[model samples]
Target: MDTQFFLSMDPPTVTYQEKRAGVRNGKPFFYEDGDLKAARQKLKAHLSKHRPKKPYRGGVRLVVKWCFPRGKHRDGEYRITKPDTDNLQKLLKDCMTAVGFWTDDALVASEIVEKFWAERPGIFVRIEEL
Candidate 1:
């Protein structure tokens, strides 16, 4: 089975971060950054409205196309800015998991992610069972 959707919102440039730990009551507590949490929540809420009826179980291929507004950059140009491609995928995949797009993100055996400058900004996602 294949699933595809487009989120018509300017994608966040923030990314998931490594766990941060602190000692509280002599106990180590791990936490995520507040910006990351907020970004994830926003993504989850956007995706929940269009989540598939059932999660994909088998190995899957995921493609994410990120379109950023053409500001100083020319249209169709690749975005070579902060929040690298891999970092962007981290948050997106986690959000996909939260919305039940698949049983686990590990099921995503292959991924194609790209970012480009565009007249309009949004995210296009495609998932196919493999």
Candidate 2:
């Protein structure tokens, strides 16, 4: 696997699923939740700062590992929580697209996402051109 680029962001206060939305004027809209918005903004800023010189235009593979702060569970333990892995991917991919990590999130032909308990919580992402 030839990795095009990699990025790591400190754990965000709000997880992807925590982003709330509502209908206004008959149109769905994300709520102006300060914490959620701030978390997404922080992710975008980090991605923009570390984005590849040129966004990947071809088929790409994305690997995302989310490390959550350890609670009663031990480190490396898989988290069985409210936010599903797919839900988490939604926000992350959106942020990557916003920061121009790739021409489009659709360019990602393969994806692997996982969550685990850890002492140092963070998000680790790797992109490989396929």
Q: Output the number of the lDDT-best candidate.
A: 1
Q: Against the true structure, whose TM-score is highest?
A: 1
Clash count (model 2, backbone only): 0
How many residue pairs clash in all the candidates, one count each? 0, 0
Clash number for model 1? 0
Per-residue lDDT over 1-130 for candidate 2, one digit per residue giving the tens place of the 0 to 100 score? 3443334445664667775789989999876478778878888887787687788889988998888888788999998884688877888888999888888899999998888888777777888888
Model 2, position 58: C-alpha lDDT score? 92
- Angstrom error of the Cα, residue 128, model 2: value is 0.9
In angstroms, give how far residue 65 of model 1 lies from its true place.
Answer: 0.8
TM-score of the candidate numbered 1?
Answer: 0.90
